[model samples]
Target: MRRVLLCLALFFASPLLANSKTLFLNGVYAATYGDIAWDKGDWRGSNFSAIRLKAGIQVVRIDFVSLTLGFQKVGFYSGMHKWSGDNDIGFDYRGPVLELHLFPDAPFGFSFAGATGTGYSYLTSASQYHYSSCEGCKIDAERSALKVGEFTAYVTYKISSQLEILAGAGTRSVKGEIDYDVDRGGVHSWEKGDVDSWKESNTMVLLGLRGSTL
Candidate 1:
């Protein structure tokens, strides 16, 4: 009986024994999906898709605004498939990322935030294209230096004093490369073709459940 009373006392006193800041950490399950159009060639319009794991930190007790910094690991899959024969090609892109956050109190006392970041991506695999009447072509190259950018907006709702639920949407742009081999037909001496600085952008939707103890 004495131990139960002592525990109750500690529970009541715990609120007064705490610090000022509320440190929050959350995991976001995100997916980016969108379409990309190309203007310089006879290629089909490309569509982009990506999956990422993102994390963030938020401070508490601030009235007007709060800040957050985030990190992500993104994996990308993209390609253009030709309609003739088996001339199909694709690229797998992987990367590490960093992000900035700006959270503000909106008109209804709700939280809204924006984010942007850079990512360094590496090309993981390349597949060769083969046609029925023409010789097969292979373009294998590994590239690890690419640029990334993002913009996000979110709404956060407090479930309790120590937990919150976040739902948001954002746009992400990642760079990649596509190489086309022009030597298969033997009609042109171009040998190889390069599509440098190729960019893919997608719209992302995410949900996060966070717990805080700061």
Candidate 2:
């Protein structure tokens, strides 16, 4: 009985005792194209540029499988031409990620990882429009909750113990509604608009720079 209890304890504690934690950062560029519909009509066929930053920490690793938690920020350029004065939108997705690595012991390795989490979307735009005789005097800003998902499959070449070069294709999708407020001639109005289900799936090349021991 004593030996069995000791074996059980060791088995439960092995992962914590032997696991190595890793930290990585990546920069991503993507092209986004999607369709959106509003109360007026179908606003179809729009494309824009996007930039994203991903930072993660691998908290648990058991052989070829690892679990990480990451925070990502993505910015989208102006796709709506009507609101084209210094306008951009951003989303934040932060949550746990899971990865599967093939050839974990080799210098050349491949891995696939995916993440989904809580997200927030923000948009800021300025335009000159006539709203009830308020010509050229309206400014709009929007904020909303977004649902975000990301997936990446990459091949890695380890240049050193702490650095790797990664080339991969990634897909990210963001969907949400925007609650916007407009200010025109000192009067305020509120309206709701949506991203109308936007998905950005593009090819990305990234560099994986690992941090020192944490």
Candidate 3:
């Protein structure tokens, strides 16, 4: 029993001890702009904002090369207005990120990194539309969904040992189906079946800060 307990304790403690060797964490804020093209619909070009957080191991010499896993949240102000007009809709996405960075050893070092991930895209809005051929009669409804695939590439400047700033561009692609129903004044109307599979690819520019514990 004593030997078994010792083995179990060491097994759990091994990861914690290894994690103490080196830790890296960073955060970024950026603005993105580009075009979102749809296969079965129209294309939209717009600007968006994002915030990212990363944590991983240094794995190499300080500021040299490292692999990090992170998460980013993006907000789109008017990207969805083109779909449903005057609805005051909001669009956003959140996802897991994987990044690789290579930094040269210098004061004004220039670094390059690329990141990619998959996430969910959310849309919210309220609007009224004509129900069937009823005169002056309308129905109200809301819509939303989950999307996938986001990619980015960036160039960074190392200002100090623990801080860096970066600017980059990236794109997000999503395809999904949406369906809904509407009710008008005690009368129920169903808009059944798949409306249309929408495919969107948004391009954006990002400017953000990265701070770390080296």
Candidate 4:
């Protein structure tokens, strides 16, 4: 986690950092569990959520549509795929993120975003840290990645020439590896679990404020 944050710090310090108005210190929180539809409408419950953070600078602005480019750190959670009181594997994401915002002069707006180029991290969890040294115990090595994308519609209120606040709700997609899909294999087979991957399309609700160009 520290390494990923350090990478983003360097990314923001590069030439891409400009004086123009942009969004910074942004986050979205959502809980995704239970019998949700995806994976051919299959159910896979393991208590996960789409918790993300990102910061970016405006790259293009035409009328009410603006595009931003910057680094994003995705996922902040203690939830797990196949968890035990002892430990479970965790995931992390860091990559170039792109976002588009559409806002009129009124109090309504919308935004869409996607992120990629992230690698799966097994280092953040204590479970992986302790057991990784043991032979043939590492998980999620083949298809290791956590992917996130979102679409949100919001109502905004301008706070100043350089700031605005928004409240919104929509859906976001998150993909990650599963040690054992609780819905498919059930918890009984957690002992001899098989590897699997899943993509979740879940609800999103957020309150955020951003700095817009002056």
For 1-214, candidate 3 gives per-residue lDDT tens digits of 3533443344333324332332335523121111111111222232333334333333344346655554444443233334323334345555555566565334443433343444333333323232234445443443435465766676666676555566766666766444434556767664533344456777656576555432
Provide the overall lDDT of each model, using Cα atoms, as 2-decimal numbers: 0.38, 0.45, 0.44, 0.45
Please provide, for model 2 over 5-72, each residue's C-alpha lDDT reduced to its tens digit, 9 standing for 90 to 100. Answer: 45334433332343242223442211111101111111112233443444444455566554444444
| Best model number under TM-score | 3
In model 4, which range of ten residues has the least summed lDDT? 31-40
Give the Å error, residue 203, model 1.
2.9
RMSD to the native, candidate 1?
14.2
Provide TM-scores for the models.
Answer: 0.44, 0.53, 0.54, 0.50
lDDT of 1 by residue, 73-171 (tens): 343323222333322323232333333223333322233334344433333234332222334743333342445565655555556664446566666
Better of 2 and 3 by TM-score: 3
Alpha-carbon runs more than 4 Å astray in model 1? 1-51, 58-61, 76-137, 140-145, 177-192
Q: List the residue pairs that clash in candidate 4.
A: none
Window of ten residues with lowest summed lDDT in model 3: 31-40
Off by over 4 Å in 4: 1-51, 77-89, 104-109, 121-144, 177-193
In candidate 3 the C-alpha lDDT for residue 101 amounts to: 59
lDDT of 4 by residue, 135-156 (tens): 3343332223566565555555
